[model samples]
Target: MSDKLTPEKRSWNMSRIKGMDTKIEVEVRKYLFSKGYRFRKNDKRYPGKPDIVLPKYHVAIFVHGCFWHRHEGCKDATTPKTRTEFWLEKFDKNVKNDQIKQEKLKEMGWKVIVIWECELKKDFQRIMDRLEQEFKK
Candidate 1:
């Protein structure tokens, strides 16, 4: 099936999608900041360039989009109507890469935190609760 958008339009739309400081990322950052959490954003020294890196706490937080990350059991992770095959391949790769990053971080003695977009919209309080616990630990 042909793409509905013109090639130029499609390119423009894709370009507008940012690689960092996305909505969910910013939201998490703001919340963490308000709670007196100091963090570095997208620190390249770490695997996956995690959205927030709290060196003092040895914690790296990743704010992932459900669709892009293929969040398991998340409603927003559904495949797009178009380019089903391509999306599947892309999402599978994303999941695999995420796992590798997490493992590397763990091996390096860092605690990894992944907050999905769907969870942000639904169980935000739960996310905070868990973060608080992690911080205490």
Candidate 2:
């Protein structure tokens, strides 16, 4: 479907979108905190400015929005029909940047974890359990 908002309006709406402290990120943080996991948020010292960093475990967690991060095969990861080329280019760049960040974090001896926004909506417990397993590693 075509965009309902004018270009100016769309720009304003997009500008309001946040890069950090998102709802899903907050949810994950709460859960982890409740589970006795101490973490630092968006540590400047790390690649990608991970949403949650556990220094004790040498782990970095990123809570990614499906559309923004283009979670592979995720239902929420839909391409915008309005600007095909623009969206594709943007998404591709996002994916590439994410990969680079992950590689960099790995090279720095940090276990990287990515949690999709959709996962927080359904079966969030699974993500928590997987985190537990990762922590145990």
Clashes (backbone N, CA, C under 3 Å), per candidate, total 0, 0
Which residue pairs in model 1 clash with each other? none
* 2-31 per-residue lDDT for model 2 (tens digits): 899999999999999999999889989999
Write candidate 1's Cα lDDT for 42-82 as tens digits: 99999999999999999999999988898888788888768
Error of 2 at 16 (Å): 2.0
Q: Clashing residue pairs in candidate 2, if any?
A: none
Candidate 2 lands at a TM-score of 0.94
| RMSD of candidates 1 onward, in order | 1.6, 1.2
Model 2 misplacement above 4 A: none
Q: How do all models score by TM-score? A: 0.91, 0.94
